[model samples]
Target: EPEVTQTPSHQVTQMGQEVILRCVPISNHLYFYWYRQILGQKVEFLVSFYNNEISEKSEIFDDQFSVERPDGSNFTLKIRSTKLEDSAMYFCASTGTGSPEAFFGQGTRLTVV
Candidate 1:
């Protein structure tokens, strides 16, 4: 079975710096998304990208946040300026055209100090 893969399973960032999180989804998947969990909180959706463009985004996906598929094979999320409150475990997920379930990556834990 194929699965989503995220790099740098753990990361540390400064309160005022920028960060880019990377992910590669299963080759046959048709949709991709980003979700985050702030410590013990519930998972929250950030954005969804499809057909080379953003399809949907949650309110949390503010101007400071952006995503890209700079390369045909990888998807990335970039946070312009990190804040202590921005620390969270980011997960990359994907699903096939008719699949009802999304397969998630192990998650990249981000810590802002």
Candidate 2:
């Protein structure tokens, strides 16, 4: 079975720096999403993309966060001016057109200092 893959299992950045977390979702999946778990907290939704546009986004997805399908197979999440509170495990997920269950990537652990 195909699965979402993320680059750089871990990353560390300064509080005011920027970072791009990359992901390659399942080839056949259409809906892509970005979720984050702040340590022991629940997984929170950041944004969702479909048809090359943002279909939905949570308040947590402020101007500091952005997502793009820069290419046919790759989806990316970029955080600008990172904050210490931004440290978390970011997960990339996707689901097929008719499926409600999403397959998640291993996750990129972002540690903002």
Indicate which candidate wins on TM-score: 2
- Model 1 poorest 10 in a row by lDDT: 94-103
- The clash number for model 2 is 0
> Model 2, residue 33: displacement in angstroms?
0.2
Residue clash pairs of candidate 1:
none
Q: Model 1, which residues run further than 4 Å from truth?
A: none
Q: Write the per-residue lDDT of candidate 1 for residues 24-95, one digit (tens) a residue.
A: 998888789999999989999999999988999999999989999887779999999998999999999988
Which tens-of-lDDT digit does each residue in 1-113 have in candidate 2? 78899988999999999999999999999999999999989999999999999999999999999999999999999998999999999999999988799999999999998
> For model 2, what is the error of residue 100's alpha carbon versus the real structure, in angstroms, after optimal superposition?
1.0
- What are the models' TM-scores? 0.96, 0.98
